[model samples]
Target: MSTQTSLALWAPRLLSVLRIVAALIFMAHGTQKLLGFPPGSGGGPAAMSLPWIAGVIEIVTGVLLTIGLFTRPAAFIASGTMAAAYWMAHAPRDFFPVNNGGDAAILYCFVFLYLVAAGPGPWSVDAKRR
Candidate 1:
């Protein structure tokens, strides 16, 4: 294949990697909340009460993203979780996403949105299944 074609083919693969990485990150946060596995105090089910629901979404959606199963729904749920995180956890501060800002949530929302629109591409299990 030509250089352009090769780059084009690999582009989706790179995006898949990004999706997996982002999902894994979200999964870790969810795991921390769900199971106080690690030594330190995790985000426990009591940390933020209402918004804690996002923890469930994060865990399920992260798994979906990892396997490229139900990509759209997973990304949608992930986006919602991030949005909730922004409003409930970070919006009280500035928008810079620093110490207590909504930056991380904003970024997470965008990442999930991208995956939703892109549909997991060639490197996903969804693609393989099809």
Candidate 2:
């Protein structure tokens, strides 16, 4: 195939991989919360009301993302989930990106927002059916 054609074909595949990776990452986080795995100081997986809700969202949306099912809605939900996380958990912090303060949530919100707009693209279960 022409290099351009090959690149075009590969691009969507790469994005699909990225979608799955992002989903899995968030899924693990949700599982951690659901299982009550301790996070950093003052943040354990016990039974925090807020974390429980976040965990449910993360798990549901993450699975939807992984399967590329209702990609748009799932991505939208994930975006909101991350946004709430940033505002509620990270806003009060003044640390930089790697400081484990609020940077991660802020970054995650942006990334998930982008995914919401981008959709799952080709190479996904959604694509296979259509």
Candidate 3:
């Protein structure tokens, strides 16, 4: 196959790889907030607090997305969470995402948004169910 065609053939599989990697990384952030694994400078959030709540969502969505189960809805929720995180926590610090440390949040939001529209690929449980 031509290079272009070869790349196109691998696209769907690459999506799965992207989802798994991103979800795992996302879960790590949640773990830091909830379990304090690898230990941050301080303890986790107070119970039911915003950070704690975000951590919960992150873990749930991360697991779902990683497994390719409930992929679209999970991605949608994750995307929204990242968006809110950027606006509430980062944007207020600075207009520039780079200055505000919102770059990763923005990237995650857009990537999750893409996954929502794209759906999980043939490697996903969602695909197998169809």
Candidate 2 residue lDDT tens string, 26-119: 8888877785453534454546588888998888988988988888888888888888887777765644545547665666677677777887
Q: Judge candidate 3 against the unseen true structure and give its global Cα lDDT, from 0 to 1.
A: 0.93
Q: Write the per-residue lDDT of candidate 3 for residues 1-130, one digit (tens) a residue.
A: 8999999999999999999889889888898899997588889999999999999999999999988999999999999999999999999999999999999999999989999999888788898899
Among the numbered candidates, top lDDT falls to 3
Q: How many angstroms is residue 84 displaced in model 2 relative to the true structure, after the best TM-score fit?
A: 1.2
Model 1 C-alpha lDDT per residue in residues 1-130, reported as the tens digit of each score: 9999999889988988988889988877777777754444734777566646777778889899987888888998889889878887787776567777677688999999988898886778899888
TM-score of each: 0.84, 0.81, 0.97
List candidate 3 segments past 4 Å from native.
none
Candidate 3's error at 28, in angstroms? 0.7
Q: Which stretches of candidate 1 lie over 4 Å from their true place?
A: 1-4
By summed lDDT, the worst window of 10 consecutive residues in model 1 runs over 34-43
Winner by TM-score between candidate 2 and candidate 1: 1
Separate clash counts for every candidate: 1, 1, 0
Ranking by TM-score: 3, 1, 2
Candidate 2: segments with Cα more than 4 A from true spot: 1-5, 36-48
Question: How accurate locally, in lDDT, is each candidate?
Answer: 0.82, 0.79, 0.93
